[model samples]
Target: MKRLLAILFFLAGGLAAELAHPVQCTLITASGPQQKRRKAQ
Candidate 1:
């Protein structure tokens, strides 16, 4: 169906964007753990 294709396309675009800026993704992921550690402290 057209809607399914559109949803798949949207997901693919998001993945491509994430891959295009791996450093940003890494920074985001890295910050999450630090925030959790801060909360624990």
Candidate 2:
């Protein structure tokens, strides 16, 4: 029972990390072009 709980906790952490990564990447990507446009202006 303890082992199963541990495994579930680890999997939940991994899933949260996987979910957060793309949002960070998209935020960076979304901001990058705007910064460049500002510089150009």
In terms of lDDT, the best-performing candidate is 1
Please list the residue runs of candidate 1 whose C-alpha ends up more than 4 Å from where it truly belongs after superposition: 23-41
User: Which residue pairs come into collision in candidate 1?
Assistant: none
**Root-mean-square deviation of Cα positions for candidate 2 versus the true structure, in angstroms:** 7.7
- The RMSD of every model to the true structure, in order and in angstroms, is 5.7, 7.7
Candidate 2 lDDT score at position 2: 100
TM-score of each: 0.53, 0.51
Q: Which candidate wins on TM-score?
A: 1
Measured with C-alpha atoms, the lDDT of residue 40 in candidate 1 is 55
| Per-residue alpha-carbon lDDT of candidate 2 for residues 1-41, written as tens digits (9 for 90 to 100) | 99999999999998899887744554444434343345555
Backbone clash count for every predicted candidate, in the order shown: 0, 0
lDDT score of residue 32 within candidate 1 = 41
Worst 10 residues of 1 by lDDT: 28-37
For residues 1-41, what per-residue lDDT tens digits would candidate 1 score against the true structure?
A: 99999999999998898898764744444434343345555
Q: CA lDDT, every prediction?
A: 0.76, 0.74
